[model samples]
Target: MLNTKKLLALTLTLLFVFALIPAAAQAAPVYRTLDEIKADGTINIGVFSDKNPFGYVDENGEYQGYDVYFAERIGKDLGVKINYVSTEAANRVEYLETGKVDIILANFTVTPERAEKVDFALPYMNVALGVVSPDSRVITDLSELSADDPVIVISGTTAETYLIANNPEVKLQKYDTYANAKNALENGNGVAWANDNTEVIAFALQNAGYTVGIPSLGSQDTIAPAVSKGNDTLLQWLNDEIVSLADEQFFHKDYEATLAETYGLDYEDSLVVEGGAVNAK
Candidate 1:
């Protein structure tokens, strides 16, 4: 129906667009796990960079801590280079969900709420709530805190939940991270700091005038690695790794190597998890 030149031009245009249709269809999906890692050749790991003796940067600008040690091992096992992503407590899940990190070894505590969003691997460490106050005036009992005085807690932590549900009389001054909560209590911003027993004990021992009271509060909880939701492949792999590591009592070894100097002998049993259970070293 057209002249030779016009008909040829129209046919070529149609062929060109048709060619692009197949190319577009052949392109892979954006959020693929295996292909993404294969392309990057590195497994990104998320960890806390401020919470010392667990995950922190040292003097040499190297990420050094208990979690870092494990992250290195994971990278080795995965046959991929380790790309460390420094993250906060609140940002850990976000990092995983956003694909910023393949795994989280950030001392993340396993909870039912978090599990709904992300899959938690088998626990490698045990933890519970504890309170730390000035040595001169320890708060052993919740009743000791005045109605006017608020406790310091890191937001999005078990500490905040525990205090809100259990101690309605006590007000809370919430910070976003462990470093801020520790600093606030150190500066006498609050009468006491409530958080993980391991953190509280470590803080008390690190600073001179503070001591941990109520060394254990609530049921024992396990801290574990977490991966994005629906990531059954990664989740299963992590759980298997945890189980294998537990058989060797690797977590106890991790505790002695990384945490013992900070906490001393008294906390060995309270903080370590071995063979799918909390054990004394």
Candidate 2:
């Protein structure tokens, strides 16, 4: 009887200890603040590796794009080395929520649905959904699309949400990355390719056989950096950075340097979001 009681007590004690252990072991991921990142001397910025004119790796294996230009400035001002983490549109929120990235510079659009998951910094660029198609045929009406004629869309983008809600019957050939979507469009996999207007406009401008038939669709939106929700220190620092950079016309300068070659000088005024102020300060 004594032995059995001792064994039972030991089991209860072990069970109690384990019950408390999980509380510590399964603690939520803690995100690093500006100070912590400064101390480490590196900021992990998540960016798309396959989206050209916004974010992509060049033939020489170097990161180059409009968003990357802004990220480079952020690193230079913060006095930290940039550790660029190649990310996809779908994995952006996961990167922030899981503490895998200090900031997301992957052309993240500010939306109420996304703001609930991650804190978005002030606007840095203007954007809207647009559709591009082969010059032979332009799709202006969503009603024209059917299962026989699909639309190429990148996963986890506003384009996906807009189509599903507005035109559910339109068949979607979803790609996890933008490069694949571009390929599918070129290969005649879909009737039209939908994405950010800025990106689609760039595509139409640079590529020969495509044209942006629908230049603007859905609501006008802005692109901004995103940090882990509740990370106020980092958020404030980024906001301050934006305001400070505005004095120098930094974003316009970034456009001139990286995007203007593809988009030309005519687009400078409409696209550039100076000092993180979407409107008046």
Candidate 3:
């Protein structure tokens, strides 16, 4: 027994609620399948433009690095061109989740927390945490750092997570980009910079008067490509491709071509993980 005006208001409210359902459904993460990517003729890959020897834009403006080499092979094998999307450490997962990029190759370390958000492909490289500081007062151990001496870390990295979890006494200077973190260290913003061992080692080698005092700080981890959650078709294809690439020792060659100068042959067998088979250490 409702009046005309009251009935009209009720009907409008129902319509409004119904209208929002489709929009809510559309807001869920969208994943493009492998076939769709191939049909598009191009795959978007997210990589760090500033993280050299891993993923970076060279002086010539070409994307060159270990991860870039692997990305090139993926594109070739898929019969598609690549569109490199510059990304930062903090935005890697967002890029995949939002469908902004089909794959993330930005030195993404595989961690349990990240695996729950984005589906990780097989690992291509092994990694660990390291700390680099000025040669004047090398920080060989976390114990050497005073409570006032802050450590530099990149946001959304394992280094930041580890320190936050393990060393509540230590202060941290967080940056969004690897370049900024390096600059912060050079500017003496922090006493030490904690990051991936590969990156810190490269920094010490390239920049004079810096030493990787705490090489191998945390547990060993692996670097892998990541796709949006529920992108099963692409995930499966990547796994298959990784295994297929093992026949030619593709990852080892990638290290030789891109990482050898920085890491040298001694790191070859240790860092390279062919066929995505990570032997239990």
Say what the RMSD of model 1 is. Answer: 11.9
Candidate 1 lDDT tens digits, 59-129: 98889888887887777777789888888876776776666678889988888878876778788788888
How does residue 206 of candidate 2 score in lDDT?
A: 85
Better of 1 and 2 by TM-score: 2
Candidate 2 per-residue lDDT over residues 44-159, each given as its tens digit: 99998887778899999999999999999899999999999999999999899888999999989998889988999988888889999999998887876767999999999999
Compose the digit string of candidate 3's lDDT tens values, residues 1-281: 46988999999999999999898657879778999999999999998888778888988999999999999999999999999999988989888888999999999999999998899999999999999999999999899989889999999999998889888788999999887888899999999999999888888988999999999987999999999999999999999999999999999999999999998899899899999999797
TM-score of each: 0.83, 0.87, 0.90
Which ranges in model 3 have alpha carbons more than 4 Å from their true place?
1-26
Count clashing residue pairs per candidate: 0, 0, 0
**lDDT ranking, best first:** 3, 2, 1
Give each prediction's root-mean-square deviation over alpha carbons: 11.9, 7.6, 7.0
lDDT of predicted model 2 = 0.89
TM-score (C-alpha, index-matched) for candidate 2: 0.87
Model 3 gets an lDDT of 0.93
